[model samples]
Target: MVEPPMAEKDTATMKPVGTTDPVGITVVVPSYNQGRFIDETLRSLLDQDYPNLEILVMDGGSTDDTVERLRAYGDRIQWVSEKDDGQTDAIAKGFARATKPWITWLNSDDVQCDRALWRVAETVAADPAVEVVVGGAHYMDADGSNPRPYPTIDVGPGADVRREVFEKGYMAQPSIFFRRDLYERVGGLDRALNFCMDYDLWARFAASGARFGKVDADISGNRWYETTKTAGQTLDLYAEILATQHRIFGAVSPYFVQAVSDHLYGRFHSKFYGDRGHLFFRWLYFKALWTVINARAPWYCVKGLFCQTIAKSGPIAGDRMTFKDWRDGFKAFLRHGREVRP
Candidate 1:
């Protein structure tokens, strides 16, 4: 691993200040055919002004202008554009080359918030024993507008981080950083997984008894566009997540079962009813009834489905919502015969 450049000096005393000997962080950006958005993503990291930063862009031989844009960065970043298996493969390759003490990956379409690296470094520096650091992030639209805070929960000491992640599915991938040693100890990412690989890594970290720390401030922006891999594949994503959980924990959680059922209904509703019309209510009711009749834990599944429905129908903006707000949103969904904004 290459050493990061030394910190800049203060004008008055000409002595290094701020992050003079900050912990190094390597950001691996796995990309392919993301020419339109890669530049902004790179700039976000470059502008962090964090001295101890290393960036690696592993491109899967993008046919777009992504290579040209990468060339523009010159030596500021290390990159390899070649044919690879997939996103997971590219990220695994980058991870293998990561030389920094700490490591994380930011997707080609995502951007790091201002000073995010600094904040992460400071948090890790404050507690050198912390093996993982999780922060907040926002869900941005395709055009980078309409930013909404992604759901985040505090995973303090002694907290069941793995259970919270499996049940709530709230950890933002880009907002997470971990020690390279922990990654090595956990055997890094599973190259076979197409989706939910990040979730799998978190599960491994927690199961291994890794110490976790949280940063309350938003540290990344995760773009959610129609063409993205996770956009219309809710059912598949959750399925993979559940599979990973089953493989790791030897049993899948009820929360994930409820999630699968809800998304199953969503897939059916979107395909047949276009997600609107009076048929929406009928489909939802039928799905609930089907769950009650067919599910293993019928009552728990029904209750979880009910709670998720109300929660998903809550106000479109804001990170948190009250129960009353969720109930009103559900009422609005019932009245309008469509899914409410969330």
Candidate 2:
């Protein structure tokens, strides 16, 4: 491995890979004004168990302590502060400068598992044809407590992608590593999209007929704080996601049709028959259910029905759902069919 250049000057004590390996990996952290959380984010990357790694922190001209915090990290990370379009563009610039053949992005507020790079490297090493390796991820609080695992996408055995992955978003961007060549081949992320760039990129990659691999272990943690974009723009994000799917998979993709039906059902029930919060809750429930049902597998409609049942029973307090509740709701819906009230 031609040991990639170190981000910081003090690498005398750190283990360095000899210049003999065929592949090097880089982890890019695309940040904005995340001064309070960027330190923890970079720490997680620096603590990774994998050897022969590069850490690149690219910021979009932060006017806060984000730059000062980056400076504090010194040589541990290679960082740059300048204006850019957004996260996607920053990531592309980082990837272009990376000396590694494999890369993954770590959002400024997200943390990587201790074994993330190790697992991704192992997957890539095992399969020369694999263009992407995705693992599981969970959402956690800032202090690393209160974990809620993201839904898993079952891509099944083999190098090919199943329709279910695309339908249900099989690969979480933060939890996956990509081959540099494949990333470039797909034209990287869409700078135009503030949200759903991950979905768009994943769709493009899947459409290319590239090979994919799965690392069964959870390799990343996403934080769900109020400052996160998803918190403020749920409906907007949903619309972007729907639109992205239509554009990438074609307007008539089964996934689009399923989304439309689920959206209609939930929108009607929640907006007309229930409170505003309940409306959004129902939309998520039905969407998750739609994903499961459309997976073309039996017993997958549970996720969709799980949340809707709670909202139907009363008001929604927060965003949370369980499989058992969904299963029960699914059964109830099937039994009553259209006769049941929303």
lDDT of 2 by residue, 1-342 (tens): 223234222356454444334356898999999898898888877776456789999999999899998888777789999999888889888988998888888999999874677667667667767887878989888677899887666654753464654556645678978888898998887888887788788778788886778889888889987767877675677677766765665332334434444455556674665433443445455565455434543343343333232333322223334556556656655555556558
Tell me model 2's lDDT, rounded to 2 decimals: 0.69
- Give the per-residue lDDT of model 1 (tens digit) for 181-200: 99999999999888889989
Q: Candidate 1 has which clashing residue pairs, if any? A: none
TM-score of each: 0.78, 0.72
The reply for model 1, stretches above 4 Å from the true place, is: 1-8, 11-20, 269-342
- Which runs in model 2 stand beyond 4 Å of their true positions? 1-22, 159-162, 252-272, 275-342
Candidate 2 TM-score versus the reference: 0.72
- Could you tell me how far off, in angstroms, the CA of residue 61 lies in candidate 2 after the best superposition? 1.7
The 10 consecutive residues of candidate 2 with the worst lDDT sum are: 1-10
